[model samples]
Target chain A: MDATERPVADLPAQRDGQEVIHLDRVEKVFEVRRRAGLLRREKREVRAVDGLSFSVGRGEVVGFVGPNGAGKSTTIKMLTGILTPSAGTLRVAGVEPARDRARLARRIGVVFGQRTTLWWDLPLLDSYQLIHRMYRVPDARYRENLDRCVELLGLGDLLDVPVRQLSLGQRMRGDIAAALLHDPEVLYLDEPTIGLDVVSKANVRHFLADLNAERGTTVLLTTHDLTDIEQLCRRVMVIDHGRLMYDGEVAGLHRIAEVERTLVVDLATEMAPIALESARTVKVEGPRQWLAFPAGQPAAPIVAEIAAGWPLVDLSLREPDIEDVISLMYAGRSAG
Target chain B: MAHGPGRAALYAAVAAKGFRRYATYRAATLAGIFTNTVFGVILAQTYLALWAERPGLGGYDQAQALTFVWIGQSLHMAVAAMGGGSEEELMERIRSGDIAVDLYRPVDLQLWWLAQDAGRACFQLFARGALPLAFGALVFDLALPASPGTWIAFLTAVALGLLVSFGIRYLVALSAFWLLDGAGVGQLAWLVGMFFSGMMLPLNVFPGLLGEVARVLPWSSILQLPADVLLGVHTGTGLLGVYAFQLAWAAALLAAGRALQSLATRRVVVQGG
Candidate 1:
């Protein structure tokens, strides 16, 4: 009955504990069309993921941070069997995602932000019920999971309401619950916090943190939100332009890139771009503008001066969180 | 695929529950009804005009042609009735790579989708298709059949037509796996089916060699064959053969559907994040 000693291949499609995901030299290349003119055409291949590989340990919460086209989703897709890899080996819950996709389905859970896995026209409760059956949760187990999800997500009132009627925050909560209903060993959350109000976003972060600690679920979270990486994952995977930039601790990301941080001033009046004592505004717009600073800076003084500026309507300090660091890494990638 | 109640029933339950949940989209269903009725009028008008000059084109009388147009409206709403033939949702899933979760679920993907689609289509048929058909009948001096046998034959033909349409749409959806623009693929499929599937006109009415080719393809079955049956043109053993062919074609398309699904899944290439 123990899961540890099972043959890597005999790895039951459903994994509950330890080493939920493993990947070796995984790559994903996409073929895109480039038309120059009415007559001219070109076929270009984008290396969305290039020979990038890493494994998610049991109960490990890994952050998949990337820019817009960074290969975060690609990595998750390859891991989950939604897309076949151009090259390399990928495994989750002891099954090869590509070949054993169906078997893997029962063992892993997934949530996509901005998209409800729940039926749009149906009640949230009904969507949960559907997921319960879709994953073949035992009746008793389904109840247990459902109860937990409702309690955790505070979905009591919204459960009976149709998905279309619910707010985005409510829908997201419902989506999270639906993914967890199956009790999969690994949960792939793609931008699960996108567009959520800060409070709702916090709730999801907290819930995810708790979910991993309590259930020992290997959670691979992909997001542009740096706070997600900071709050959830100690291990981080950075992908850019369809290639793995770095795979290591979250701290290593800032070190890998000359992290670019920006400070914006909501100026009361217009002014030309000014060079900062410590850094420069890489690029600037009119009065309401941005000033780029080296990753590590004494932000307190800068904010204080800005707050004291006569024309400054509002002033806020920003740092390169996960998105900035990952983008820099991506922009620095070696071309194929 | 799994025999156990836990998984198979779970999928069915989810699909059923999801379908029930979708029933709440009264607004959507209502909108569909309005659109379908408008389209039905257009179809009915065309049918009425086509048979006006000819005494019988493929056995269609004045009344029967109207029936065919009405039935086509119903089938268009029915084939993927609820949500079965949505290439857009599929494309979004693919783009976001959310389809990974879908691929993992322990159920027949096609069946699960087909069931949900049925929910939408069924709602449209009642809310939009049937209502439009009735309105068309009332407004236009369309013929009503004299015998119950005509009704039975018509029903059989309409059902067959539904199967054929569903198969064709599903085939079109498979194009999303590879196509950069899923909508383009879907549009192409719609355009081809519209021209050849007899959505616009009976295959017999086509001016030249195109008409001959149209008959060979199942597109004609979407509207033409059902209309033919409704008009009471196919008599005696011919009826049996036509019904048999319809069923046979459905079975063949079902096989093709399975094949396309497998092929598309295999072709999935998770692109850049």
Candidate 2:
């Protein structure tokens, strides 16, 4: 019980190379009663997570990608013990999340991109201090983590600022730092790069990469951004309609679907669609055109040709989303 | 209990953060203080007129009635037994699925909320309660406890009363787990608390069985019991009995709240997904 005095080394050692997150036939069914009419009520069971099963080893950065209402949020909630599973076994860091939520909370950290866990009215530092006490992070460890988060997340200037006043990027960074302050062994990130600019997204990705490398922090990242998956995760799991659609390498999923990458180009003038050798024009508006190129093909040549032939104002590449891949996978299966 | 000091330190820190959170709303606090003071004056005048007509009605003189008015005003915000506070925020969180963040913490959910509520009540006791009481005493010659010991007992009663209030509100807040929207329940609780907490009128003044029933209900601890203690109505062993009564209700309500919380957590529906 002397957790304060007992050093990390003095604690019971974990099993060597154990699976940090494990799920077997996990299912969550929600009973929703909607007003069918003026008086009649309809009771239906929604299988949010249907027999989902996966296991991640220590230090694995696995990306869990899905479209909206694809059971990613439900799975995350169950993993964090915010909601209990209707059936099946789920464990994180050797503890059942729903049964021993508080015990597991000491070892796992969670971040939701859409919502902040920080105190809305308090300064960023105050929230961190409260977290420090809440988690019982030792004084020295708390200082060390705070200093590291400040340095790495560029939160030095933002510490004294109230969280409500921070920009989205700054607040997102603050949230990431707050979750990591407790030095949890496993980190669950839900849409970590959902709504961030290119620079902030890159910074977050870089920080997460370094964190995994430096601390061996096992990360379960659920995101819509393919680039986030491509950059940070080697193994990615794709879920659709509450079921596992694909589970393997990120590159394999892209290749199997033969998904097209979109190149949105803004032309200088409202001219006819520019025909290209490698890319096909999908849609065209006044002064703007969307080009579809094979996911495997390089966009550099297409960009070079377009830039040389047409008066190009500005252009950006949109990576194929997980939803695109999942839909394409279904399309491929049906076509075959 | 084994992690006594560490757990205490964590909840104390949380309580301190809760206090600082309320302190940030400087303008709101000032507005609240002003509103409580005005209500105190209005209620005092009404009580003065009634006590004058009745002449020591319900074992209270005019001065004692005035004191009850100010005390009730002070406690309305401090105890917040009539609802509308963090409980509403908690309900909103449940509806918005933001309670996920709260559930992620390692601490006991019920105790964490209790600590936070305690912090808010303690701050309101001074920031919004004391001033109205001072104003009533200055303007209306309210009943004052002569002994320092009685003041200490009164403060203790107030603390216990806060626990009772928190317990009741917590139960109402957790109803959001099943109801999804606790607004209706919150209003009902507020109406019941207002009628029984001796806020609208002292429970002692209630006629017949209504007074007996209101005096024994948990709401009485929020205002009536504490007010009675301060007025020297409950003395010696009688005072201890009043405290014991408050303690029992607080314990019972809090335990019931804890039970409901566990039940709610078991089947959490986290609205968004």
RMSD of each: 6.8, 5.2
Error of 1 at A307 (Å): 14
Worst 10 residues of 1 chain A by lDDT: A2-11
Off by over 4 Å in 2: A1-17, A36-40, A259-261, A271-286, A291-319
Steric clash pairs (candidate 2): none
Listed in order, each prediction's TM-score against the native is 0.77, 0.92
Interface RMSD of 1: 2.5
* Regions of candidate 1 where Cα sits further than 4 Å from its true position: A1-17, A31-45, A66-68, A238-320, A323-336, B1-53, B56-58, B79-85, B88-101, B136-153, B182-188, B195-197, B203-213, B231-237, B268-272
Evaluate candidate 1 and give its CAPRI docking class based on DockQ.
Answer: acceptable
Q: Residue by residue across A1-336, what tens digits does model 1's lDDT show?
A: 322233334222333345667777888777877997998989998887887866666767777877776677767777877788888888887798878777888888888785557777667777677766666677899999889888988999998787888988888888888888888888999989888776897799888888877777778888877767766776777776666667776666666676555778777677766545776766556677787765444456766666665366776656456665654655666531
Error of 2 at B79 (Å): 1.2
Worst 10 residues of 1 chain B by lDDT: B79-88
